[model samples]
Target chain A: MSTGNWLDARAGGARLSRRGVLVGGGLLVGGGLLLAGCGGRERPSIESRDVGSDRDRNKRRLREILDRQTEAVKNKDEKAYLADLDSSNSDLVEHERMVFANLRQFEFAEFGYNTRRVAAHGDYTFGPVFRITQLTADESPVGAAPAETFRYRLAPKDGRLVIAEITPASPGDQKDALLSGPPADEAWNMTPLRVVQAADNVWLVGDDSVPDLEKFAAAAAAEAAIVRRLWEGRARFPGDVMYLTRDDDNYRRWFSLGKSSNFLPEISGFQTSRTGVRQNGQVYSDQRAGAAILINLKNIRDYYSGEDPRVTMHHELAHSVTAQLRATPSIISDLGSPTWAVEGFATWATGVRWPSEASRYRSQLRNGLGSFKGLPSSKDFYGAKRSLNYLLGWSVFAYIAQIKGREAAVEFYAQVIPLNDTLEPFVELPIFDGICERTLGTSAGAFLEGWQRFVRRGAGA
Target chain B: MLMVAAIVGLLGALVAGVGAYLPTNRYQATATTVPCRRVVCIPVLKASAVIDALKAKGHPCEQERDHHWKCELMVGTLTFETTIEEVEGLISDVSVLVVRPPDEEPTEAVMDYLLWLAALPYTADEALTEEINDWVVDRIEADEDAEAEIGGYNYYVVTSNPGSIRLRVIGALR
Candidate 1:
């Protein structure tokens, strides 16, 4: 791909419109207010500092809002958190519900929150950005510790200090800020659609038109349920509001709408296009708010007889959950995991039966194996033979997870992400043997032979 | 002298005319006169048998039992037939030849050329039909040859000979 094409591939080019501004603005206010009451004594002083004309006092007020937001998230006070939001923006209210819903997954002890003051602009202030460095327990034990920074915009609302907007910064943005440089344009664009409470801990946002809000809400609720099941007893990033749009242009626009907003360190956005085939009935894209799993509506209707969209939703959510745990440094950083492992774990969580599709895919592989021996070029990633890699890799990963356990497999993935190497060694025999021997107390050569045999048998059958 | 010449010419004409009517020495014994009705029946049965034979060789053919079925069997220009009394015995000598026309004007010796072509194992539709026409001519010649081979048979009687025989055979064959 050319540089322009690469940029095009990454760029959805959707600007944060007035509605997005309102929604993003509402969450910072809502989440900020809930945190405002965290230190009961600090609340009065924080309010008074807002009245002070001194820049230091104003900065302190901003810092206090960050502190309270962290505290409010830790306390899980949905009503108190929502009370600070601008009621005029129902979208923001919806976004707050989403943030709260995701935050409810982790225990307070699992959260490691810190805030740093970056810069201040007139009435609209940026930062004292909060970072979630570690979640204590994860279903997938990523080898690396991932961190995110949340940029909070504080301005006076109703004669008192309140958060105007909250934006999540990418790792690249954080690196640029550390270097005292302007964040990269691409990095600055990460923003989640504002959160809103739908039902109980379930949150909804205006991902689609108001008429489809109920449908979107139901999808959000079902998605939350799947996440709850997959990441049960594990600390995770919050589930995001489900965005839906039939218009391809609108879907692309909705995905890129976070560019103009302040960054949130912890929360991530999940954006997907209404167009394109959902590979394996599921596809996902991750941003700062959370991961969005875009189920191709037509495929769902055509292929899945059971009419369960939740499976695909959960599969994509699994990717989001894994991403949150790994939190790769660069957007292009390989998680040092095989596509199969990533897809398999997600598939397993989503209750995909591999054996059913195994025969069809095995036949495809056997017929195409000669052409597939060469390493796939980037273009080949979407080709028919790619399914061989997905299926085979998934089987291998599933086997590793089954034999050595899911925790070890996840740890292996985490270790690989920082290596910055090609995936050939991981897929090869000797290295796999070594990894398996060390991690699973098994011989790698034996495992390879066994897997080959298993695959051959599957093909034969 | 003119009268003598005229008388001699008249005598020569009389001998030529008499010779034309006389039986030729070549097919004196083998030629037999069968009824025209039998010839017609033979062609239909032989055509049906040939179609069945072609089908048996894996050449798919449509079998029609209606009035127009026999007419359809003559798909190409040439056709030939042979028959036996019992119908079952018809399989021994019965042969139906289907001839396909050549692209250009065929030469006079084309019939003989087609007989030689029929001896080959495989035949395309056009070649096969042409060969059938040639085979019909060969069978007629064979009848003449058979008469010549059996100059006189003690048990069987010969009804026709070569010169007059050719006309009678051709008429009956058609």
Candidate 2:
């Protein structure tokens, strides 16, 4: 198996084991050193008290506090959880507020809770404990699993326990914990946030974290809405999945195209993954019935902070969606689309009308046209004059779609692959001429001249 | 009573003797040389903003020098000769050295040698001369190739390589 498949298998196995631990409440303390008599010990008599009974009372108090706090979280009672906080400690109060706010951001049908530790000093008590809560979808299939374990920390406040710190641990941390004896399937470090059910067959999973999960979800949903609108009547690929990771390592390892050299443009996302293939003018299927797209959360944040990340998402999604609508039965199809058309179409679909800084694009195109004779190479597509390809392809596709209608445009987009397979130009002058003659009753050369003239006028060259 | 009078006289003399032995400026003005890294030596000569303003522009001052000090840099030759007054205006804690080639040369050759040595790496002694010679050869060859179209010339133009420049700067300080 390839490296990517191996990693996926490991990640899947880990996710399953994490799920088991959340349900089982298996204690993993120290390094795989399970406490022997944990489940076997019986409760001591309530009336048994002496001079050393303060320690016992404190332990009892910690257990009581934990039980109440866990119940409050399981019931999704934001007010009850906050009510347990000590008003004297502002830090504890703030932490509780943040944790509850994080939990409330997600929609879930059920939750699970576990408390690990509780310590007391005189009148004051601090419980540094783990609370694992499961998130179940409302319309889950029979025996369909609930995505579980959104972890939280509960600390003592106002003589009571309050939820504090709700950030998920990293996968590396989970791996360390597992090596030291925590169950294998703990999702503490794995799961990304947004998972979408696209039609009946396709599932778009965005596993990324943001300082603002709500905003991320909204942005993701907006991008998905655009895809649904654009490919309304097209064929859908089955079990086509997209995975987004908010972690930096995930983005650098998976998505960094220049560094990794995996250059599989069709299976593009913010994070890196293996390539995708189409077969004989159709989309191909694997055992999982889908493909995975991983996006680094940190990179997304960086790009979004500087520029609109919506376009980046749309660009990757366009490749995945387009490939899905054009897969075959048996023979594997290489990514036959030209760099110009593939990137150009996505650029257009994402509404990035121009490449780079607008002023720079205009001046560079004007200079390049004045000195050069033909189109720039694929390598130079996104360089200084990267926008030229997008401008040309969009104009051509728009022109065809306008006169020939949307169906014809879709058909033309699909045909470019087969045309490419024969080592032919995407639209040879003769073929373009024939399409124009059939669709709009125009000659190919006249149309080409018109396009040149229009572009020159647009650029004021 | 005689014993008491003698004790008082002795105490008075002791106090006067202690007052007479106070620290003097002659010792305070004396400067000591400390061994420093070659990289640190050049920037010291460049003089900080506070020192540069005190000494008028274009006036080279030898604020400090270490002839006997041990140093790691021992390449190109560096020399300086200046009065304490001139350097004191530009810097504090000053010393000076009069630099000369290993052997005497014609006046024109001396001027060229001084300029070339200033641009090269320097340390206290002749320890790094071999390394400096190798660097000089490589530099001359590179210069010739770069300026080949400019026609042949006896005088070589020096282009700064970053590594060599850093080393030279460090060596000057030492």
Best prediction by TM-score:
1
**True lDDT of residue A169, candidate 1:** 50
Give model 2's TM-score versus the native structure: 0.34
In candidate 2, residue B171 scores what lDDT? 22
What tens digits encode model 1's per-residue C-alpha lDDT throughout A106-145? 4332343333224455646554343442333221222222
- Candidate 1 lDDT by residue in tens digits, B39-158: 312211233444444344333444223211211122123221212122222211222222223232322222222232221111111122222323233333332211111001101111
DockQ, model 2, C-alpha based: 0.00
Residue B128 of model 1, lDDT score = 22
**Candidate 2: which stretches are off by over 4 Å?**
A1-211, A238-242, A255-308, A325-335, A352-387, A398-411, A418-424, A429-446, A459-461, B1-174
List candidate 1 segments past 4 Å from native.
A1-53, A65-114, A117-124, A131-299, A305-307, A317-335, A344-355, A367-370, A374-385, A395-424, A428-431, A438-442, A449-460, B1-174
What DockQ does each prediction reach against the true complex?
0.00, 0.00
Q: RMSD of each candidate?
A: 42.0, 31.3
lDDT of 2: 0.36
The per-residue C-alpha lDDT of model 2 at residue B117 equals 33
Worst 10 residues of 1 chain A by lDDT: A274-283
